[model samples]
Target chain A: MSFNPFYILPELILTAGGILVLLAGLSTRKWEAPGKIKPYSPEALALLTLTGALASSLALLWRPEVVKGVSQFGDMIAVDPMAVFFKIVVLACSIFVVFLAADYFQGIRVHRGEFYALLIFATLAASFLSAATDLIMIYLSLEFLSITSYVLVGWLKQDPRSNEASVKYFLYGAVAAAVMVYGMSIFYGLAATTDIAAIHSKLVSYPPDGSPTHIIFLGLLMMMVGFGFKISMAPFHQWAPDTYEGAPTPVTAFLSVASKAAGFAVVLRVLVSVFTPGVVDWTPMIVALSGLTMTVGNLTALPQCNIKRMLAYSSIAQAGYLLLGVAALRLSPLALPAVMLYLFIYLFMNMGAFAVVTMVSARLNSDDIREYSGLAKRSPASAVAMAIFMLSLAGIPPAAGFVGKFYLFAAALQSGDKTLLYLAILAIANTVISVYYYMNVVRYMYFAKPKSDTPLKPSFAMNMVVGFAAAATIIMLISPEPFIQMAKHSAALLTGTP
Target chain B: MIPLEWYLGLSAALFCIGIFAVLSRRNAIGILMGIELMLNAANINLVALARYMHPHILTGQVFAIFIMTVAAAEAAVGLAIVISVYRNAEHINIDKITTMKW
Candidate 1:
């Protein structure tokens, strides 16, 4: 019944930064000369906001109080360690994304402070999505996230591809959202409460479990339709390739990594927290969907020439692995940790891949795989980073992706679900299919010669993001222990185990 | 003086109409309007159930408010994207916007 504003410090910081950037945009410095030096300007404002968000999220590490479920806004926003941990992850990824966006906007002449403001606004929505424990809150935050993304995907309004991406994304997403809300109403009609914990209690204490199960599953299924659109899971993934390929590269990275991660975060939280496995009649259906999604994503990815579209399919494939984790949600000690770990690892690997795409495109002014024909000779840093991202995405050994996938399959194995094991294997084979396409990019970077002149210089921010994400991708392979430990600790909170 | 089943039936019929709109309309904005109708059906159901069941008045109102907020946000983003696309392609048709086709 009380509001603890401090519990939401990271989101508060980001939202405040959004406001500051909005106000700062109106007060541009004017100079008598053509190009005079204006200190404390655009770059400083963006970097300052990014730094503030990072510091606030990092501050969450020491707040042991919130780890134990400190409620704020009448328990509407929870500040548990799970939320805090993912907030840190989201903040780190957002900071990296904004850094890339800074470079991207400068290059593309979209240096409006509104771009920074929207990035912050989107991050705010992501944080809310992470912390929501009620259907009302989740729906609102999801909309917040979607609208911001719709704008960001269409940031370059003059480009036909950008406009098309935004329109398609918005239309598909609007239908999904409606379906999701109807699903929520179904649950409310059956259970009489929207709070996740209350709904769980209602179901657990209900007389006829079958009746409640039917109603709740309908709600969950409808909700999945919405989230499936967001995360680009198969059958619902028809929007992904177009949107990802058409959006700006920086926004593409955000869409693939942060936005998709946020979508899974909501799915995991709602499914694991509200509806136990017994309540839902379709863990196998989920497992089957996982199998189909990975296979479809990889098989389609193998034959693509446009690098961005290939990555789009590849992202869908990654969504399958996350779906496997969702199917294995209630399986074992490893179940929750595996999903948390995969999401965390995916942040590094996926964003790194987009960084490579962005870097190559910036240098070559093309997103065609052929443009990467001689990246090794021109920019070995990007080439090696691209290779690492590709290998990691393919679930190659000695990388975080492999470790994450192993934990997921091991959890499925622990659950003793034969169908899920089949999914795990199919996912592995899809990884192999993915390897061919990923290596094609690598082959283009190393083997074939560039069809045109390669750039002599890489943008400093691109260099920073690539190097940072590449290092994280490798380092998590070595000391994945600490991150894994944190993930386990966080997941245990949901199960009330640790 | 409509019976409860009739009210529920009307809302369900409205929901079906909304689904029909979504399936048939090629204009992105028209599809968005369909989505709005579907949400409104769900809202109608909420109010009906509240009126019939009468277990809690506050929860239904809160839900209605939340749905409105979601509908508003959806409309804003949906229409903005539609206008942006119309400006670019000079048409509101979803069929012609298949540049990313396989």
Candidate 2:
């Protein structure tokens, strides 16, 4: 028997991380030993475990490029450039989130080990969701992610807000997901296949536009609705700001960046693999949904005062922008790269924003915008980091966010969808509106007066992590060739075009 | 024996009911239950359609099985969250638990 072990690197790293946390919970002896079952000082122990996991994920950077369409487990996984690229992104994101989580758990009553374990497990599931080529695999993987996240969201069980955030999240998430499954069943009924590729092949010539199209259209719409709820797109995005605010900051960061990206990952897969050459008649509906989502998310965000809530609404709006890329799947020269590129830039811009939120909140014990008044006077490096993230998010010049939006709008334009292109331009206008709220923080940080004896110290860890994110944003803006090329290559796997 | 349209109609009705509950339910657990019913409806549709449309194919059955597994996992996490809510607020009614209600 031959051993085929090449495609398991990312999974192995994640599994090892999860097991390490579990073992740490089991093996550690304690000075006071709070409880025999509940590990003592689990925070420090969990932090170390997260560090180890982060290191393992970084280890993937050394592996050779994985081409697309390298299937495993009866065509369960498609280990192409797209999958490999996203796996790395998810992996790297988990590592950063773990760094942010340890502090957030300081006073929380949960076992830190379990939190880290759940984090690893969720990331692993997300990776699976991203790489899954079969419907069964996608559903299974998404379950793994959802369950872990449900627990993580409510990790601070003592806090009513935390519990409420989680409950609302679960209920809404469940409904959308069930709807998605129902839609999938419709596809299964029509195509008689659970493999995405098989279903796509079956769909290709089944009378391009007819009653079948209507039925398939309904199914696809239901499916995207479910995915939309997951990513917290507007109309379906009611749960995000609450959940992001109620969850611990680290968990919020992970949920916003990695989890949303993971969901988008599958959205790409569904569009590219199962509805290749585009779900023609379905495009108009998506464009309209995308337009409404972007417009509503940004417009609502204008009145938010809570920092976390602002970011939450902003994230929803960002998902709308990402949706524009998805809507262009059939319209452009290959929209997959556009999607990948946006996600890549999103990891930096969004995470940097969350990192600033986490760090500032950790020190100030608040998530209110007013609390961030005079951050620049208090902490220069952190202040500057916040500035760059704001600029990037607003899609200002010399930010990766600008380049990403440009590419996506360009794709829509090339797809010859004048309406979508106009919506994309209006999306840019929303970006301008977003700039105001984002800059409000910058203004308070630089202009307002500090109000506390709170020591404003930027440590090596904060500098290293935030600066790394900031530096990445800068590099992607100045010279995004390598990364865009990587995204383009990943795009090829889905579009079947080089 | 029930006709295949009966099963499809029944499944569609169940799904519609699920959607209605999700839209109207105030309690978080109640909403989750609605979602569960909807998923079960999907499973029924998949099995019925598989048996009728492609009598020889097992794909729909397999898909239905996956849906069930996912639903089970979802319930586990969801119930745990309900317990978490009760612990925090001393209330099981999601309507009263507005502290974190978004």
Write down the RMSD of all candidates, one decimal each. 2.5, 3.4
> What tens digits encode model 1's per-residue C-alpha lDDT throughout A1-498?
567666777787887888887777556532222121134454456567767877876676577776667767766777787787667677777777766665555446563567777887888898888888888888889889988999999989889999988888888787888888888877777667778777777777776644556666777888888888878988899889999889988888888887887788888788777777546656876887788788889889988999999999999999998899888876666888898898999899888888777766765677888888888888888888889888888888867788888888888888887887787788777777788998999899899967655454667667888899999999998889998998988877877821
Q: For candidate 2, write residues B13-91 as lDDT tens digits.
A: 9999988987888777778878888999999999999999999999888888888887887888888888877776777
- lDDT tens per residue, model 2, A132-236: 888778778877787788888888777787887888788877887888888889888878888888887788757655437778878888888778887787788
Query: Candidate 1 on B56-87: residue-level lDDT in tens?
Result: 55676688778888788778877888888888
**Which DockQ-derived CAPRI band holds candidate 1?**
medium
Q: Pick the candidate with the highest lDDT.
A: 1
Q: Estimate the lDDT of model 1.
A: 0.80
Cα misplacement distance, residue B15 of candidate 1 (Å): 1.8
Q: What DockQ does every candidate get?
A: 0.75, 0.76
DockQ score for model 1, please? 0.75
